[model samples]
Target: MHLSNQGLLVILVVGVVAGWLAGRVMAGGGFGLIGDLLVGLVGAFIGDWLMPQLGIHLGVGIVALIINAFIGAVVLLLILRLIGGGFGGRRRWI
Candidate 1:
């Protein structure tokens, strides 16, 4: 399919916002512009798929989209941390 310019813009904005929000909440700060955008975009995909599986729907709208992405981003960050990616670089023993 084809996506309009406006649609693409909206996706970028949402990804940035969601990524920043998740970084701040999980990492206690933003992960720069590019980092935030990447995290958000990947998170958006996770949220879009995981949300429905867990029976969690935030309705429809820009706000809902952001919420979904934010949730997904948080989850992503948490997973990364558990795997010792950004969790103080400490190796977990368990």
Candidate 2:
């Protein structure tokens, strides 16, 4: 199925918001705009899967989607930090 432009825009907004929120929750986790977008997009997938498995359901709609993605992004960021993941030689976000 083809996605409408509005749908794509909505997704982007959700991703950015979710990623930003996750970053706020996890200090030094924000990977900037593009990186946050990617993290958010991937996090959305992880959240969609992990939440259900954990018996954590946030209901439906955009707000729920954002919450789900934020939770997932926080997890992703936590893992990255655990693995010593950083951009270039920068360990702390500036």
User: Candidate 2: which stretches are off by over 4 Å?
Assistant: 85-94
Q: What is the C-alpha RMSD of each candidate to the true structure, in Å?
A: 2.8, 3.4
For each candidate in turn, the TM-score is: 0.88, 0.85
Q: What is the lDDT of residue 50 in candidate 1?
A: 97
TM-score of 1: 0.88
Winning candidate number (TM-score):
1
State the displacement of the C-alpha of residue 77, model 2, in Å, after optimal TM-score superposition.
0.5
Supply candidate 1's per-residue lDDT for 63.
Answer: 99
Lowest-lDDT window of 10 residues in candidate 2? Answer: 85-94
Residue 12 CA error for candidate 2 (Å)?
0.3
For candidate 1, write residues 1-94 as lDDT tens digits.
9999999999999999999999889855677899999999999999999999999889999999999999999998998877866754455679
After TM-score superposition, the amount by which residue 85's alpha carbon in candidate 2 deviates from its true location, in angstroms, is 5.2
